[model samples]
Target: MEKTREWVITGADGLDDLLVDELLALGGSEPRRLKGAIAVQGDLAAGYRFCLWSRLASRVLMPLLTVPSGNPDRMFDDALKYPWEQVLRPGATFVIRSAAAKGVSTHTHFAALRLKDAIVDRFRQRTGDRPSIDTENPDLSLHLFIEAQQLTISLDFSGDSLHKRGYRLAQTDAPLKENLASAMLMQAGWPARGEGRLFDPLCGSGTVLIEAALMWADAAPGLPRIHFGFDGWAGHQAELWKTIRDDAVARRLAGLQRPAPRLVGFDADGEALACAHRNAESAGVSQWITLSQRSIAEWRAPALNSVAACLPAEWAADVTGAGQNYSVPGLVATNPPYGERLGDEGSVRYLYRAIGRQLRETLPCWDAVVLAADITHADALGLEHKHTLRLYNGALPIFARHGRILPAEPELPLAFEGSLDDLPEEGMDFANRLQKNLKVSLKLAQQQDVRCFRLYDADLQEYNIAIDVYEGRLQVQEYAPPKTVDPAKAEARFKLALQIIRKVMGLHRDKVFLKVRERQSGKQQYEKQGKAGKFFEVREGQATLLVNLTDYLDTGLFLDHRPMRLRIAAEAAGKHFLNLFAYTGTVSVHAALGDGIHGGAETTTTVDMSATYLGWADRNLALNGLPDSHHRLIQADVMAWLKDERDLYDLIFVDPPTFSNSKRMDSDFDVQRDHGHLLRLSMSRLAPGGTLYFSNNFRKFVLDEALQAKFDVTDISAETIGFDYERDPKIHRCWRFRHRV
Candidate 1:
């Protein structure tokens, strides 16, 4: 027997055990699993066998040497030790691929250059002729792994990834790699469960379907691939390679001559089906597979001929266990889309539920493998999973859940009727509740011609979300639910609510924005919620304010403060106005542009810490035709600005955050803890007979005793709570304070 060399086979993460089993099943021995790579001792023939036969491998590596290498000189000397003439001819082109430990200086790209330079220099010094470098189609491909102060150089036996079998002509946005798709089928017991049907109803570009066809025909994954890294290597065995290739072709032809399995693929996209056909043709498995343009939602399993026709003798009994006499046993495996947006949750859940229903109504007792990013989606299938395999598709962590589709039950209702207004039963209850709430506010909103207001504030206990309308657009903020509730269920309800709101209001998808509201600390409230900087002008009585529904948690204008802004406009005539913590300066804009029923403000000063909001304030003033010269927009901490103010103002509004720990602040500010100091400072700047208005949304706010004694304080929270916000009195709280002269 020829001496064996140590070989490492690498694959995607979460598939190391499978790859190790594959290597051992091949002619490799002493298989040991490392991180994402499996090490095995194998002869050169065994390496070539794995390159051709192993379906789960990403790359096959033959280790040449290991050397201690942290310093640049040590790395160069270690790489130079290899005999360049043996690995490559004088003019042969090569490329190096590298990976390194966390703190290494030259990790991948730079490390490859260093190793290549050493190889080139060694050849130059020995024969005065160096091999050229080729990155695209290198004759010799080298792999280096640098960990701590050690570097291990290996010869790559697989040119490109084994998954790239020269079959994929087109793909969708997130196609599963071919090798991973094969692993999924193996995990589901494909050919081993012989004579059983295979289906991928959501097949995108048909990678999964084509792999299934190959499995049905006993075809090697690499049989169609024309190139391997060992083709031009020094140890190339052309005759032995040709023999192995010939054997694979003979086996494929023999398998195709036998009765093929019922392998079928269905996709709603016509172009995707066409692409799948092209790929299957290129793979030479087109005759073994069938592709169709149809959605899984309308899919029903074909009827079985007799009890004997049911797959795997136990399936008939299992389907009979669900109180159904007839049974169809097969496999349904698919990689469904992982929706990354809140709006996408509804559709994803609907698809999963539809699959579960089709399996129950049509193909009960069948085994299934569903690859989904969120485990909640698998759970949404309304099936009891036998087990789950964790896997990685690119950088995303996904789960391949294997389960038996059970009989339909009321426990997990399939509520996907395909429309927002016609949501499933549970979702309908919430949508109807929103409809009722909208009815209560629609009349009042139309009478006043109000453009923006809160339509729903968690009207139903189960749906923990708030829906607000800004002119024609809608913004939804879902309050983080307690741990007692299932997150997936909560998310599903939120998605359903958004869709219903859009349909009810006839709003475009782009006009709706959804955000998950979590508990905030520090100045996170001022952070930008999204990258869309779109702002639209909405009417508020006589004033026009700019509002952004997509960029932040709170729109530019506070709808609950509509009545309050009107109050300020009534009393701000001929008065010098001061707005503190002036978010967007809506009140100051009203004061500056008052109708002069009494008189308008002589001058207005709007102070806030956010430059973005200050810029917004300037825009609001300009929109309302208020001149910038009379209005001063000061960007500073309200507390710091209050300390420096000596001028007197007739009217002032101080509405600070309930709690603020902004990084720019010298110290944290809590309305309850520091209200006395804040009030005293602002009151000192007020004229003798001037009144101050203070408000906050702190549900449990309490006025300070010292400040109450220092001035005549009147709680006007009841009067300030407007009609639109009358349902929730604590939406905002306001007070009137007159200085004791």
Candidate 2:
């Protein structure tokens, strides 16, 4: 008999519960879950068995010390007192890895260097020889975690992550890891009690099916491994470990004698199917798995009665026990593709709808789990998902939808219904110019598949107003005429321009709207023009934003900033993004969407002064399937908040008004006078190699001369404004800044 000790097992982000279940089934006691790990009391053999058989774990750690450090220096002193000769052999090469613990130091490399010094000094003080340090191939692997006020030191028992099961020699372009696959399987109830049949419609490289077969045969996950961290430990019990592993091999042989479980997989790529066949063969589970090539949109599921007939001959012949009655529909689990493309969302949505249609109509009683990264695609499925697991696959945050498939009503796609309008007569000069502008702008809009864009921007002298198309409706703005002009003449000309616009576009009177614009600053710029609080949804490149054409002087989205918004989306992935004065959080949404909709920024923080605008920002995020959990929204004065923030960001956008006065503000803001101080504070929060964009709509705004000598600033006004906004080059000025390192 061996004594019991507490052991810690670390798993993936969302698999702690599954880890506890596996640990309990493997002869462990008092299992408890942690943030990203699990703890249990087990003996030597218990730990060895789990290291060999448990499939849903990343590493198995053996703790040496756990204590609270009220002082920072005490942690280093405590490490020197720990017994290093007990498990670590003399003269053996070892290395220590450190992760930046929160509320402590932000430099992880320095912390790791300090920890190494204490261990070497301890070994030299005790023995005559100094232990060698080998980072590439170390004999012992040490882990040091310095959390807020606590310190945990442990030895890495499982070397080279347990997810590398040694069977996947060939894989698809984006293959799923083995442990994540096992977690999905357990969540779908495979081999739990009556876990019988399983199917994968979009199986790539056969990761899920092979994991399922391995679980069914009761085989060890570490059987093919040649090395572990404990191999060089002086206190390792080799005889005890061999006995435990031999018993597992005997159990695996006996389990193989029984009937095999029904497992099937299909993929559209021939090369991917070939890799799946090769991988299954390497795992020695080829006989129990079936592979096929099929397209999702064109393929349909087999009836419940004919399932057994379609299976392989060997598995189909046996209709008893594990292979029996296959009358019940089994689980369908798979991972699908998603991302942001310029004009390819329609095709992606079609693929997801096809997946939902087959699951609902062909397989009535089956349970299914699907991994999709885009929320819009998941909605296209048209099925009520009972449970959703949000996790990251590479750089993408994806949702795993689990539910029972049943028939549901499908949504019909809407199309435009209208005839082309006839050209106006030769005398109508304003109408002729409007049609010409539309010829170029409308074609560009259609090529990009965008539904909202500017059609005319004061093209003719008499009709000096901007016209924009939102979906099928129109917004017409009339700039206040010069004071010298006669009021009667100005009013009559505005009416004529309105009439021409209505005739040229074939729009009803109710479909068109008009607003009068004047030189505004501060609170007047955001004042409401009308109380028609209605909002309509419009599509930009990859984001669907809400636009109110009547309530405020300006819509939620700034049409002039379209080019800059797209640039943010292209460069925001895996970076810390910040957006100041984020009116409605449109740019923040683009940052989260990143490069089809697949990748996005690691996190985004949006700050503004208006609570009403922040509430609107929150709604805009929800429409894009984004939660405030990762994208933070704060309501505060931009200038005050900038001076107090200590966190650093990789990308920052600062777009302020030329002049502003608000009751909540400390003082009235003038961009020309306050920009120097505002920019300095914002730059202080920029991380190394980070970028900050400064933009304003004031026509007379100028960059301060002192800024050029202190920072690396480049005026990108010509680049940030798009072709539609080229007519008015001075509509806004944009500059990119960086630290002068």
Candidate 3:
């Protein structure tokens, strides 16, 4: 709407150069570095474009005028000299935000008030009335920056901080502002890495990876935002802005079509990873990110496979090739837990040490960037950085250290890390029971055509663990012993159980993955004892699904649900099926597959809270020749989703966790307490004569008798339990329900 005008762009202090580069690249020129900001000259369109394209700027300001400050009275009179009628319309609302230097006014409030009064008085004098002051959501936002006896009044082009980006709907504790995270990646030479993975090992909520993905995709950071400060300004160019916005959309589409580099993130905290998944999806980059709940201790290269599978079909070969061994050259940029945030110095040191070891021992030939709280904590990494730039996360000064990972050294495998002597006892009585159980379980599994089954589930209480066989690999899960049992004794027994498995099963260490199951307080399906893993395809009955033995406590496929899936396939012909709290959509796929008995289902809707699981569910459905048109995957809390759901389904499968409390959800859920309400909601959407299959892993779960009175109900746990899972009949409970006549 106007010719070139002076604009100041503010960002994190240490990243001014990056902001300057962005300004020049976005139709601005002659950028001059200022304290905490950069000054540039640009037309009105450039100001709006920077708001959309700049990933590291906090605010963009267009200075209306600069005048020297005398006393308060004289400064107010000078402020009135600006033509108020041109800047403000009669009865329009505006707000003034200001910061003043000591030389300008000792009282910042007094300075701001004087400026505010001058604007109002000028409007009143020029016209018949003054504009109203709307502090929140004002039509116009004026900013005053005063220093060295000079005041520069400007309009804040960004109504809100540019760091909002409108993507982070969920977050973890001590999150870095979006702009600061972008600055960190820029300092580390990210999108510039050109072709390698961008990994964040301790990616709390995935701010860094999300920013990196959005930038790489050429998606304007502010493209999704509805409003800007300039929208209400007199000079906003609606047509020019529309043209720029349309071009940005086209650029994003082209960028998405190109092959995207692998982006991966991992965290020990399941809640944080869940937040990250939703954040990436909100940012439209979930398809470009691989997120898993994994401990840093399990971090190692060659084991980290690329999980982002949404790419051009032609490029799948290259992506898969690089993922097989993680041989792609990349940058490891992460902000790990440090003392100030974590408070425990010892734990912080331990985290940093583990990070350093992984970088040096596993990620050879890769460059690394880490943001740490201070030098003391940073040094704990035991890495020699090539450069360290001082910066601030909000107000806390931090350091971004860049270094090249030391070439990996040759390693010798340990015999179970620390071989427990005197535990196996050659022929322990418990070992004998496990051997017998395994033989029976294997025989039953073979006869039933089960590739993955629970072989031994604490058959003997002394060795309290479950050994599962997935194709040929074995995953031994040690269920945490009750507190009444001695810790040392349990540890000894677990070690002995492993030794016996090696001898009896004749499997090497490489073929076995270990997970320790502990009673959890969060979503246990998401929160698992399993470590990071490379997922592989597994054929179960008529459909192929992906599973990872080391990824989570529950393999993406629930072996216990085999009979239920068979039931779904038999009953799903021509019926619209709904699977609520669907973990990996195995049930939905079975419904779509139709089990050689019924025709394929008419439609299927799978709902789950975790975006990670939903992604897997989609791949499962697609693998089984199901199209997205008829098979829809919805990511939402089932409880909340049910209220707005109106479609009626002929066959409904409802399975929920015993207890769950997610930031993505409205409230915490207890299956026993909420089942009645949950079941009633599910029943509302059931078509006449439709059947609902409800199940849960909570051992003590009892179906509410009231549901029986309201709807026809039958206990089907016995029928759904396959031969392999018959031993632990109480492992899970199942039921069948229908509307009463």
Among these predicted structures, which one has the highest TM-score? 1
The models' CA-based lDDT, in order, is: 0.77, 0.76, 0.78
Q: Residue by residue across 200-265, what tens digits does model 1's lDDT show? A: 777888998888888878788888787898875887878888888899889988988878676677
RMSD (Å) per prediction: 20.0, 16.3, 13.3
Error of 3 at 700 (Å): 46
| Model 2 poorest 10 in a row by lDDT | 314-323
Give the per-residue lDDT of model 3 (tens digit) for 1-741: 478888899888688777888789999998898878999999878988988889888999988877776567877888888886776655668888988654444666777899899998887787868788899888888898878767788888887889899989999989988887877777767777636477787789999899888878888999988778887788677899999999999999998887876887877677888999999999888998888755453344434443332222222222222114443367778887655554224335435655776676555556678888778667756654677878888888888887766654443221121222344465467666766776777677667677777788877767778887777678898998999999998887788778888767777888888888877766666754545747665666666677878877677877788899988888998899999999888899888767644455778999999977887786666444354546788999999999999999999999998998988899999999999999999999999989999999999888899999999999989999988788778878999999998
Better of 2 and 3 by lDDT: 3
Cα error, residue 126 of model 2, in Å, equals: 2.7
lDDT of 2 by residue, 1-741 (tens): 899988888877767677888898886889877666889999988888778988988888888876574444666688788888886897788888876444576565666666677788888888967888899989988887767767677888887789889999798767787887887777777776224677787788999899888888888989878887777676789999999889989888987777877788876577888999999999988898877654442233332234432333332212223323343356777876554311233335545665786566455556677877777777766655667766655556776777666543343222222322453453278877776777777777667665677788888877788998887888999999999989998898888777788877777888898888778767766567789878776667656577888888788889989889888988887799999989888899888776443457778999999876676676666555453446788889999998789999999999998888987789999999999988998999999899999999889897888988899999999998776788888989999999998
Error of 2 at 362 (Å): 3.5
Worst 10 residues of 1 by lDDT: 410-419
Off by over 4 Å in 3: 101-105, 194-196, 301-328, 382-384, 410-741
User: For model 3, where is the 10-residue window of minimal lDDT?
Assistant: 309-318
The lDDT ranking, best first, is 3, 1, 2
